[model samples]
Target: MTGTRLVIDGVTLTAGAYRLVEDVSLAARPGEVIGLVGPNGSGKSSLLRAVYRVLRPVTGRVSVDGTDAWSLPVRQLARTVAAVVQESGAEFDLSVREVVAMGRTPHKRLLDGDTPEDAALITSALAAVDATDLAHRPFDQLSGGERQRVLIARALAQQPSLLVLDEPTNHLDIRHQLEVLGALRRLPATVMVALHDLNLAAYYCDRLYVLRDGKVTAAGPPADVLTPQLLDEVYGVMGEVTIHPRTGAPQVTFLPAEPHPAAPTGAEHSSS
Candidate 1:
């Protein structure tokens, strides 16, 4: 297989005194697309950070290809894993091509420059994200969505066996969102992405793990995990889930929450 196997077993993450994820266990086979879906403050990002080596778990282990991730050297880990996180820093002063080319750093000596092979990968990555036109432009001048696409291209250039992305569709138009995700779906890498869009996740992911309040609420295939009852319980909203006839993916239609009963009029509270 071309991709890496990821095993996150009995992992618990905490921030000082606060627990962000509690006893979470998940695994992704080579070349599978795994979705992490949950509401805000539901520990999805925290879990991702742990996988990408930003946060060390308080308990349990994260292993890639049977090796403990924490025990690997940073450069070795970077070669195997690439992450596109939400909190990307300030605008770079470099050109878009330069930023994307940075992905080659892990494989090169400090004095080494871009070889023809590196150039090809850079061009291919840009094309993969539909960002080839923006390559010559300065990265600082691009809009949010453009920068996001460029970041994704950078990750693609790394050619990691496992790719982790947090809301890669954010700031993208509908067309580009589909393009980016479709490109990811075709890659020979194991992908773990956290998404707020249920329909998109259902369409792209081979399996899903639902998080809520630092715990896993559910885990399974879309058809098995995304029932109306699960949606209501986990998201606290009424929703209808159906299979799309053509796509065969679950589609969710959310309805407004029921209103609470009104209090009695002022006259009913008056004392005689």
Candidate 2:
């Protein structure tokens, strides 16, 4: 869980004439949770893909522990980093335990069979996400929240130093959303998550990186970045900012606009 120092220097992703993400530079240190927040179409996923080596950046470099990520062998990278994307589909209808056991694939040699230790690790991972009881159940039949937990357990079984999650809270209920987020926060890895919920991001992320139009508009502690003005300008919504009484973190309240006064008719205008 330590030694995960991720750096993206001047990274840019382009598709034809359009740039998806532009000059995005940031770092995630060990034991820190950095949240990437933005509206849809804001290139958060594009930036994450570049960092996780899913999509190579057309410009700049991504380094993990001072090594060029692209140069690292695929197996080696998989051993060190684990990702939980939005999709958790298993066409073969594997059980929860089998799904979690797949995380050990990167660590296994060719033709290697699972050891007792591997089984223990998988069991622990499932328990960590509170999916132990469902270990024998079919993964495909589980609810969305249960499925997301299983996917996270799969990531945990990898024993990664860094965990990258994209919208991990999607399709989850409020309680499960908080539970998943809480489990992520408790992990020792350096976590970088692409989040749609600003409140969750503010509560859990050590720092917030606000992306807008393929660029970082603001980056800092949540209290400094999640201001009413910034949220309005970037998200195009009016909101009130408040501090959570318990955590003292930034808590936001969206406010709909009041109607504007109508303009006078032509006769009133002429008289004026």
Best by TM-score: 1
lDDT of candidate model 1 versus the reference: 0.95
After superposition, the stretches of candidate 1 with alpha carbons farther than 4 Å from their true spots are 258-272
lDDT of 2 by residue, 1-272 (tens): 56399998999999888999999999988889999999998889888887778889998999999999899999999988899987746553789999999999999999899999899999989988888999999988998888988899999999899899999888788987888889889988989999989999999999989999999999999999998899789999999889999989899988878866788878886853
Q: Please, what are the lDDT tens digits per residue for candidate 1 over residues 14-122?
A: 9999999999999999999999999999999999999999999999999999999999999999999999999798678999999999999988988999999999999
Best by lDDT, which number? Answer: 1
Q: lDDT of all the models against the reference?
A: 0.95, 0.89
Error of 2 at 122 (Å): 1.1
Task: Provide TM-scores for the models.
Answer: 0.94, 0.92
Per-residue error (Å), model 2, residue 232: 1.0
Worst-scoring 10-residue span by lDDT in model 1: 253-262
> What is candidate 2's local distance difference test score?
0.89
